[model samples]
Target: MPLLRMFRVFVCCVLALTAMGVCGQNSLANQTIKWDDYTYKFLSTGQSAQVFDSAGKVVGTILSMNGDLQMIPLPGTDEEKLKKSFADWKAFYARSHSAGGSSSAGATATPAASSSNGGPAVPCPSTYGVSYFDGTAWKTMMLAVQMPKEKSVSLSQGFKDMGKNPLNPRAGETMIYRYKDPAAPLTTGPNPSFCVSISANFNPSQIMIGTVDIKKDHREIEQAVSSRDSWLPPKRVQQVDIKRVSETVVVVTPKTPLPPGQYVLGGPPMVGIYDFGVRASQ
Candidate 1:
């Protein structure tokens, strides 16, 4: 009789464990994850939070969390639940991005960002840097600096030179640069394969690239502004076209084919810009 009682107790314990496996008693919000000396918890529902505009104003929404992802665990874990959560976030990210939702996060509080300002905001290797694909590899382009003027202006071979940056070029004597060679050290074929990457955290929208202002002997990039001042030169700023090729990275190209000349990528006086020359392929 005692042996029979022992066997029954064992069977009951197994049944209880099986029941727990089928039921999700633990969820991300209720669980605590301890790794090393740090304690972490699931803080987001894996949905879009708040979106921001150029000036950082609230916008719209994306996907909503449908179920708990276990947040992480195995042994009869809710694998289906986890998959659904990921799918929801992925679809939501696409819709939110198209709507210009800058603060959208797919799985947690991580932001898939974008820029509305008139400059390259992210994912250019550096904050204010650019690169070009040489059919072999992507190479870093150098930043071009004008002699340091104050206001925006235009200069050409002899075309009525528009206003020029009036600020002091530097603490040293104001000077003009003359170049026997192309101002940009790197040169690309007229139809270069350069692109902008819009991976998560890389905002490719607020970017600005322009045709380098060619003078008698020097090149300047002062006309890549949104102002489009009648006093400034025309066709200096080139609009960018964005196309997403994957989950995190989008390729950006000049909407128009570049003509043979110098081009600048980047903006905002304080941040500076990257430059390269485009020439006929030999």
Candidate 2:
């Protein structure tokens, strides 16, 4: 047989095998894992402590953040990664402190606000980018962070329910994202809006989006996280009135500063235009 033909045949077989493994897999609450431009890190204990993105992809690992502090391997990822995540956050806080460690400058600010307001240049400290909906279109701006080598193992095991590990807290910890409002409603008159949703590789665990309503808009546009057990976010809706500049252009400013660390935007989902929609106004 021709060598070229044999190579083609081998490639076909590999593709076929991969498709079979994915096609019949159990549905974990109708969630799909997207592995595009996304990679995870494993911590010292052979678990994943964090996931970073090179492209504008929503690659999230099971982790949390308090202020600028990233909650590394809850109890078990990298004994060092957890300590490092905390250490990095502490150092960041120390630098931003005017007198105390509290930053009055704000952590995550929207480009629109930063450009117009003469404030310190807001950096992309979070893992993911900002997502927006303009009724007719969706827009997202994302930034990916690099994972430390020591935490690679923990980052991997964190997404799986592999019995009990010495590092992670439970089978899977709560995965968090910076959820933005879907510009248009799912239905025209009265229905669930096309809100951004999230999922993880492991079972039982879920993504949560928490929102807070800063403006007295009858619609409570707050930052929130979504999980099977509950949906949460550290802050409430700070702003509303997401501007749909064009069909695919949606711009919003978060009402409050975003928590430090990595995050992702879920969607610029399909929806209609109207003043009733919501946006994450930082």
Candidate 3:
């Protein structure tokens, strides 16, 4: 009878342990949500945080209270698709705000400014200190800087150029560049042009612009970006025309038009590499 009782107790303990293990696994799975190539972990505060791929690594704080999660695209994400996503989110946000419903956690129900082109005017996050080129002049917008605790060395040269400006007296700590109209039609030219405002301290000779060889596999690209040792190699190092618009502003244009692929604009020692894409004109 004693032996039987002991065996029964052991069985109960085993069952309890098994149940606990399943519960723990469920909890872990519930805590993480994988969206595309990125895995986002829910914080204790219920906020979903995403880090930007730039020099001053900005964190996008998303409120997930109402189960409606709106987010900015991760760096190296297809820019063309992101524009559509942004538009959809903006519309949803606007409707929610109009209905007096909470659109995002901690976000007030304020209507976003309407754009001249009949699209929702999405304000850029001020945390990254960004400006945009409006065809004629560079206009500053959403100038806020939130520096990360651990300084990242992987910010692209283009990001660095946009963030660290000396001329703008009212500029924030870190600078970023945004498109005036994200949904603007892609430039259908022989070569697409990218412009950057160079700081006085930056050495023009160290700036290197080349096409990046992105892997066909999304997992491979994510792994390459995450690993410090996995610096993706650049192909066809061509000389680009570095036209100086001002003492502080310079435009780097490739001599030949880039084929439809991913590219990087930065220099050797490979610390501040930036990523851009060339999509087929639609």
Over 4 Å off in model 1, which ranges?
1-44, 47-128, 148-183, 191-206, 221-234, 242-252
The true-versus-predicted C-alpha distance at residue 221 of model 1, in Å, is 6.0
Candidate 3 is scored at a TM of 0.29
Writing each residue's lDDT as its tens digit, candidate 1 over 162-183 gives 2343342321221233233446
Question: Which 10 successive residues of model 3 have the least lDDT summed?
Answer: 218-227
Q: lDDT tens string, model 3, 143-233?
A: 1111222222333533444466645343323222222222222222235444443444454445555543343321112111222232333
Highest lDDT scorer: 1
TM-score per candidate, chains pooled: 0.43, 0.18, 0.29
Clashes of 3: 7
Against the correct fold, how does model 1 do in TM-score?
0.43
RMSD per candidate (Å) reads 13.2, 24.1, 21.8
Order of models, best lDDT first: 1, 3, 2
Q: Quote the lDDT for 142 in model 2.
A: 33
- TM-score order, best first, reads 1, 3, 2
Candidate 1: residue 99 lDDT (0-100): 43
* Residue 176, candidate 3: alpha-carbon lDDT: 20
TM-score of model 2 (CA atoms): 0.18
Q: Relative to the true structure, how large is the alpha-carbon lDDT of every model?
A: 0.44, 0.31, 0.40
